[model samples]
Target: MAAFTAADVKALREKTGAGMMDAKKALDEANGDMEAAIDALRAKGLATAQKKSSRTAAEGLIGLAVEGTRGVAVEVNSETDFVAKNDKFQDFVRKTTQVALGLGNDDVEALKGSAYPDGGTVTDKLTENVATIGENQQVRRMKTVSVGQGAVVAYMHNAVSPEAQDLGKIGVLVALEGDANADVLAALGRDIAQHAAAMFPLALNADGLDADVIERERKIAAEKAAESGKPENVQEKMVEGAVKKYAKENALLSQIFVKDGKATVEEYVARIAKEAGASIKLVDYVRFQLGEGIEKEESDFAAEVAAAVAG
Candidate 1:
């Protein structure tokens, strides 16, 4: 009997981009171990690296606020896109974000407990919204970035709609520190923010990348290297090279700027700094793509169709 269920096969297929049969076969080989099956698919070059932000199932909006050198990003989640487009829901996110910005903190629980603009705590307002909108809502997370000497620029990619200004699917904040003019810093910061939205870098630099992520890449690279039929030393070099390449690509500063393609993001920033006659540093950034890291529920299309036909 097959050890994995049909749903397991479906999930494996979604995660690895493998065909249904391939996912099922891989899962069977691994005795229903999802991670092991994923590795098997990648070892055979049938699957790509795991996208950390794989599922976009959580419907929500990202609220952004920038006050001079300080900026904040707040993610408020709802159950459906219908609720996301609702005016009341968007207003809750916008007001919550402003409250967070005023708090100048990164604590979601604190922001939830803080007073809302409409004479209630943020959490009170959220509960009210959920009841009034007839959908579950949550203040998932928030982050703030600031630079004393420079600028904290903001960018929203694919705003929920034209009406949802300062709220979007992807919100980015970039903090640059330097003595450059405000206009120069704002321009450069916004360009970097836009790049961040497109690139979706995992960390500010290669060294800041998560150790678990690096180790997983190493394991996958080693498995692929073993297939080369090369000497042990060559295999070691290949594995290290692959790991380094993965880190370089995932790290924000080491990535090639999406704008020019030729220049690395670090080099691009440096070039701008030189032009502005200041030593600008990319201090920090936040790239909040809606529904990141959320495991969304899935349905069986076959079952649903069968049920509808029977009905």
Candidate 2:
């Protein structure tokens, strides 16, 4: 006996989303070592894939910038939302995004090594901000999109400051390729970027969507169809139909335009192209939602207060 208790199993379950029995088995196998138990569960693929380190237990702003046909979006995270709203933090995010635009690369590590406008490298400036602001901060990620001919439009949802609408919780960049008039292309790009921010499309089109995501959707559809007790042929058809619907809903070009709800994004682009007298194609897009896919640690204020009073 490795001296493990029931509480250990419970904690393991909570941390890994594993079944009670599985957690118990893992703990027993690890001989009461919590870390080893977690590793065992992960090795067996029985635990959630999320790494403890990757959990973005922070709040911050998504910064976006567009210069002519090029645009960049960067997510800078802080330990608290209070720091996210700080003017200095916001300025850092904005300046970092501008620097990212110049780099024209998506590598955050490389961006950190790049120079900051004031003087030192971006990493050095960030370290200075962390020391002065009294909070742990990081430049989490960056993405850039561009078009050789048309325009790259940026949109920010729930903008922190109306005066400078480049910083927000959700940032989007849409690249439109065409030879249309600059004004017309800009207007159209704005509308499309707005739509992208609202709809949160997974990819530009069905063909571009990740194969793993498509397969996962198919599996879910197959399970649902099985539950219906239908014939084998009918079940197959049902799964296919469900997958097509999923693609239409999740793919950007196939999704219905959020602004009008009357036409697909592709159709909307065609309509705009007809009006502008130039062929416009949506080349690419990037959407960054702050803290997306990162689980935050939950705190119990009441329990903390009780414990403090008891102490």
Candidate 3:
């Protein structure tokens, strides 16, 4: 019989985006336990997503570097965005991305263990940088894509630094594999990269999407179909049809072309191939939106000010 306070209900409402009364009821159902309340909401299908904590709070730069047929994008996060604008910090991100490109390694620990120009390991240099810059920083993640004969074009959205070097807050890498002119392929790749940044497609193809994600969508669609009071056999067919539609909508190749909106992405690529006089295959793509999946710590600025004054 734990009593849930108004503040507790408000906090739960903010976190789960449920109404205040719903939040209070949820808290009461969980006996005033926040984590349990989150789980309870999930059990009742009230939450659109599961809460994930323990992600990095650090924020800095997402670097994109393309050389020859390969490109790499790495995220180096600091404690503040101000440090992301620092010249030294930008240089670190640029150089680290270059290092990542050559290493052909995706493991953060392995990249850190690799050599750096200034003597010690990459991790060691990063540590030295933290002390020198007076801000805590780390290489959060890296991804690489390459094509043997095609082009890997890159684009930086909202670039705030040098053109030839650092891109911006959002970085995209698109690899086009084909026999077309490298220049033409590069242009097409850039267009696709920009599309990726805007579209956020789930996968390159139907098979690439996570099984769990597909099943989750399947369950939801099946439940909706069942509500029609249709026969179970007919409902199964409806669910299957709905799943196919979901796959096409979420898959990159089946998605409508963002450039024209009249054709699918596959059709757009086919048009590009016809125009370029060669068959173009989108081998892979990487899109990093500054903090798409990361949750930031929400603080009460007014309360902090009052506490400082009291101190």
Candidate 4:
């Protein structure tokens, strides 16, 4: 028989947040050795992360951070919204965004492989978090934006706290290029970032818009034109006009400014530049709305209760 007692199992469960059966099994496997049991539980936790990976993680927070002229936005997803409110989860999101800012690249896989502040690799820490938090968590996506001579500003929508403004439901980073004064650049960049968070533009400009998206728009426009029974030449003109309008509406620079609605984003930047007496260029931007494209699994609480009773 294993040498460990009931108290050991309880302690192991408290330490690792493993199920009672899992804790007892690990303790038995370790032959009452506490450290060995911990190692076993950690290994099991890694396995648990793998098992939970297939579960949809469509709720959580978008974390944003800026350092000097560089900024990063990250989307960390949890299985439920409740997990997003967890202090530990918020801390992890904040720290992960900070780590991402240092990386200087927007690669999520590389960020996961990077060292975490507390101890292990970021991926390892995430696995441990899943074990402790009792839910699947994912570092879904990350984006970094930087300007060589200007500023990268970050903005968070639905901020949880004024102090920790980086944790929120939506995050935006705008990179402005030019030799403007630091204060002026930061102010302009913040405004642009805020606009980005609200507008959710598909690209910085029409030229930067996705080719497939343009093609899809073109196809839809052609179909619409066909329904009008227009001449072939007129239909061609109509399709081209429709595609251009779609691009203008979806691209950041061409989109109407959300603030005053009197000017396009490009015009707004030009106006800001003239006022600041500097040539400011809207170089790039990134916006992340938490779980924007993820489809969450729908649960039927009544059915679940019925099944439990039947079982």
> Each model's number of backbone clashes?
0, 0, 1, 0
The TM-score of candidate 4 is: 0.90
Over 131-206, each residue of candidate 4 has an lDDT whose tens digit, in order, gives 7878999999999888888888888889888887989998888889997798888787778778888878999999
lDDT of 3 by residue, 1-311 (tens): 55778889888766655566667888998889998986665454322111211334457888988889888999888767887888777877888888888887578888888887667888767765554454567788999899898888998877775654355788888888899997788788878877887888888899998999999989999999989999999999999999999999888888888897888888899998998789899978888777667677777889989997999
How much does each candidate deviate from the true structure in C-alpha RMSD?
16.7, 14.0, 15.6, 2.6
The local distance difference test score of model 3 is: 0.79
* Candidate 2 per-residue C-alpha lDDT over 1-311 given as tens digits, one digit per residue, 9 for 90 to 100: 55699989899887765678888998888888899987777665512222222445468999999998999999998868998988788889999999999998899999999999999999878866654454667899998999999999888898997887899999988899999988888888889888888888999999989999999999999999999999999999999999999999999999999887899999999999999889899989999999897667787989989997999
Pairs in steric clash, model 3: 59-78
Candidate 2 deviant stretches above 4 angstroms: 1-56, 302-311
Assess every candidate by TM-score: 0.77, 0.79, 0.76, 0.90
TM-score for candidate 2, residues paired by index? 0.79
User: Distance from true position, residue 180, model 1, in Å?
Assistant: 1.0
Error of 3 at 254 (Å): 1.4
lDDT of 1 at 243: 92
